[model samples]
Target: MVLRFLFLFLVLLYSAKVNSQLLTDELARLNNLGAVFDDLNNDLKQAKKTKSISQTTMAHYNLAIFCSNHRVYTEALHQYNNTINLLEEKKNDTLYAKVLNQVGSIHLELRNYNYAKDYFIRSEKAAELIRDSVLLALATSNLGSCFEKQKKYKEALEYQNKSLQIFYKLNNDSGLAIVNESIGSIYEDLENYKLAELYFKKALKYNKNEKNSRLASIYNNLGDTYRKTNRLNIGLDYTNKALSTAVEIKNTLEVASAYKDISKSYNLIGDYKNAYTFLQSFLKVDTENKRLQSANQSNALQHIYNSKEKESQIQYLLQLNKANKSQKLVLVVLVFMVVVFGVVWYLYTLKKRRHISKELDFKQRILKIELDKKQAEEKNLQKQLHIKTASLSRYSLHLSQKNKMLSNLSLTLKNSLQRNNVDLKRKLTELIKEIDFNLAQEKEWDEFMAFFKEIHPNFINKISNAVTSKLSPAELRLCILLKLNLSSKEIASILRLTPDSVRVARYRLRKKLPIDSKEELSLYLMSF
Candidate 1:
């Protein structure tokens, strides 16, 4: 039994040393004097790292805030103190002053009024060092809170008013919310419930986010005010409001207070069943609070245990140091080989990328050359098409002018026939018939259509597709003339038809097409 007991003791010691008592990395760094921590802490390594603080002050501050907000006051205090020590050089800094004020606040929460007052005074002095108005106001307000907790109403009021004025000038809602709540609490203690409610309401108005712990506190204070004023139902409502908010925030202290207040309010209202239910809840929270208090008491002993564990770690490191010499040499060789391989691999990849880039550039150059060749061919085709279109236009114009001359000559011969003998009349009649036959000839029109098709390859096909029905030969002739943008009179001369008849044919052609009636037939044909 004695041997077994010794064995168990050794196992416990070894396990404790190995586990480091579950110390967080930031906390462990804050504790040790050594630069080296463990294998995974290579990132923490630096020249003269031992002399400088291991954990950054900001890390400590954030951790402290998290712990404080979570009701892990012991860890919060530890982090806050170490952070202050690390920040000793900048005692006048705004963060230093803020941290000092926050430390006092934790003490205030713990009801250590003397220590709270001392820290608040230190915080206020630190703020004064830099003349930081905001920090000064915060420290002043916190000092007021500390004094208020101590029942020093006059001093509390003095400090609170000074902070309140600053908060108002800055238009800082959060600061206003906190200071106003503090003032309201003072008035409540003084038996001035009306004034307390007024300030509490002001605090609530300024506090935008309802989830805030400060909001819970203000509601709780307001409930107390109403309860003292004998407004039982109203008081119960506010207390329930506080309880809901405190529950949402998971603030153990405020939650406990809210539970207690509810029990008392139910008791006052003769709701014994509800009162009993709330009393049980309050007791449970109180038990948890007592446990936390016990944890707080054990925190000092835990700190000592950390020191011993750190010493053990140091001894373990020393033991490993003797064995690491050969291991380090092997590690160095492996690292050198890795670096050599990496360099070779990098050069190979760079060569591959350059090869790929050159291929891409060559392909791009080939593509650009092909694109330029296509563009030049298209430009040459456009020039050839334009010359063909001009030749077609000139041919159409020559036909139109020739028809006009033939019509005039036929009209003159008809008037000459009225003054002549039978032979001359008969000859004049034959000549007029020949002129009329030439004027009505389809050859010139057929040639114009053929030449037009070459210039505008798909025009006839597009027109056929667009027309509602198949066109007559005369209508097709009119379409070609319209495509050439010829006026109605010019088309009349070319087709050997009167201008009025040409206009009538154009209107009939428009009825067969898909174009709007308001649209010019010539312009519509030209679009195709």
Candidate 2:
């Protein structure tokens, strides 16, 4: 009796230990899920504040998925409702269909068959509108699952086949695997074990490298088919594989289901002790999972309630702050208006002063231009006068040269006649008279006087007024040459006289002039 009691005590202790381990794992999973929801909630709040519709919708969808995974049905429904509302507002047909499909899945999980069917139908219509074959395939596959849950095998098979066709066309291996698994479940329900096994094998082939939960499900389902066909050893092998995968992923629900499947396989294979042990572990894990789920739901409800209360208080404080800012804005506006008016007046005055200064500058510029024009005109007149004086000096030298050449010719002719015959002497004398007339031509002297008068219009009048006595033509010519700054030798050449005679004439003229004895004759003539 003591040995039997101890054996019972050990079994009970083992069960309790498994329950504790399951509870601890479930709590850790819940905490992780809560962390994910917190991050998503914060993102949702920011997206709403910034008016980002797409980000807000995605946050809502992800939060719904998290709630669904934790079996928080009501909270999942609330988040999915928010996602659907935003998607409807944006009119995003493809994403809207996907959200509707997710909503259907949530309803399916809750066992609301009729509601799940309705949502799946709506999702199909939205997907069809956008011609999105992938979303349509998802909706169709979900509809098959809904029908399968309701025991409508024919309807489930039809929808699954339709979804299968789309998945083939799209080459969606994941969708194909899901549809095959559902079809296999439907066949298993109808007791067609061969067809069920065939589909399960196909699902396993397609589900290679899939998520741990999905692979675990496929292994568990395949093991069930093997057990139904009395292949107990093969069934136990698959079930053990499923349990290992489920435990590794920390999926408490799948772990419990795998343990139950493993226990059933052992029982069918005549391994009663292993079957009993696995069954106890399954019961312990399942019970702990349910308790954890209940606790998590309660915590989530309290958090939401607190958040709503805090939000209302924050809204009230924001309103008060907005009112205070409005009053400050009025004061700021008054100061800004005064500053703007002062700046405008200052700019106007500065512009007016600049305009007046510019006008004065313009007048001064015009006056300077007129003065420059007058100076240029005077300079041009002086240049013309200098050119005329140089021409007259050149003409005087030419006339003197002509006179000396004629006198030399006359002397040569007279000498030639005296050496030849007395009769030719009379003819030579006539020729000499003609030469003298040419040498003293009044026309040449008049032309010289005209040029000199143009250069020095007031010079002759000034000299005549300065001198006490009237001046001879020769003396006047000497004074003009001296005014031109000609040397005594040049003056002698011009007057057709010897240099000594020109010097004597200059001395006589100096004595006649009313000037200082030390002053030069050229300087005196220039001043006059």
Candidate 3:
């Protein structure tokens, strides 16, 4: 239960309360709700006082609907403006779109063409966003009405036909009635009375309500179309029916319209007496309507009571906004706190999880270090072994070259033995000296020394340090071979000399060293 409460609280903190379809349905039902101005005004004030935004919006919407229905356009326009203001910043797309359409309608009714078209376009976009076909159709129909009034017949028909198609597909009788009426008005304005009469009849056919003001309006339009088309008798007959229907519904505006249509129809038929009589009736009704509209302007109506209404309304709105400011701030602060708490809670849980894995992480790190140490030791041993193998191969190549040079010298000496005795002796002496010089200055010796130093990098330096005097290159070579622990015969063969001669060189090399004779020479050399 506690967990559930936390979840609910978080949900409330995060979620915005955009209005639902239920609010739209409620607003729709208010059109038929019979409430006077004073009652609706009271409802609006109470809703505003409570700071219930949805209720306030609905209240304003209801007031606007009633005012527009009663043809109190000034007040209706003001209320529609208020409704739009309240719904503008909301995420409630459906209700916002519907409200936009209503505001556009109010502007259209007032003949504020630019404002009406702008609002209709905005509503169209909002409808498209939510993919509401019904809202889309309604906005399209109103846009057609605006174009029609502006004398843009082509554009008016285009929009009207589009909306008509939508309404037909939806099978919406109300939408069909509205679109057909708009299309009829367009045709009527273009003086296409035949098409006008046809559409007006279609509008009547779709409209289920016979006693309503719309039926009276359709009758008036159809009658006017007939009067223009030279069917005066038929026009007079339909105009009388319009008057009857208007009188039945107590629609004062429609009654006035019917009277004017009848007067015009009578005039067209050359019936001056009937025309004059109906014209008088039309004038009386139209004058009374203007007077009543002027008289109806109260402190809230700007037509008569502009000053006090503006002052009081401004003051009331200021106080209402001031009161709402702190409430909104409080809500915002609460939301911020809840968000911060959630983040801190998440971090705390994450810390606990990290703590649980701490020992395992430490063990893994130790294993990684041990594996790295073994790998490093193995690499070091392999590198040393590779260096020794490379040194041995280089030394073997040097030995083979020396042996081949010695064999060439032996063959020359053997061949010289078959030459003339005197010349051969001279040649033998020169060749023997040259052979001895070449052995001392062996070309491969420098390269062998380089390879020997790689395998025993410090050997030559140690040999120099051991002897107080500088040794010849041959003595350095003797020290390196001793480090290799070669026998005397192997050293003699490598140097192209007798074993006894190699022993004499070794003895001479030892004499220049600082070591005791008791220490083994090869062992001493190997230490370096």
Q: Judged by lDDT, which candidate is best? A: 2
TM-scores for all predictions = 0.47, 0.55, 0.50
Worst 10 residues of 2 by lDDT: 7-16
Estimate the overall C-alpha local distance difference test score of candidate 2: 0.83
Would you give me the overall lDDT of model 1? 0.79
Residue 186 C-alpha lDDT in model 1: 94
Task: Please identify which of the two predictions, 1 or 3, would achieve the higher lDDT against the true structure.
Answer: 1
lDDT for each residue of candidate 3 in 236-269, tens digit (9 for 90 to 100): 7788778777666656678778878887886887
Each candidate's root-mean-square deviation in Å?
24.6, 25.5, 20.3
The worst-scoring run of ten residues by lDDT in candidate 1 lies at 33-42
What lDDT score belongs to each candidate, Candidate 1 first? 0.79, 0.83, 0.77
**True-structure Cα RMSD, model 1:** 24.6
Can you write out model 1's per-residue Cα lDDT over 1-528, one digit (the tens) per residue? 586346434533543343233223324433442332232123223312544554467666765775575456777899799789988998866888899899998998999988888888888899889888788888889889888887999999999999999989989999999899989989988988899999999999998475878988888888888888889879877887787676555566677788788788879988787688778777876776666555543553464356458868998998899669878888999999999999999999999999999999999999999999999999999998888878888898899899899989999999998984999999999999999899878887778778888787898788989899999988988998888889898898888889899989999999999988788889989999
Candidate with best TM-score: 2
TM-score of 1: 0.47
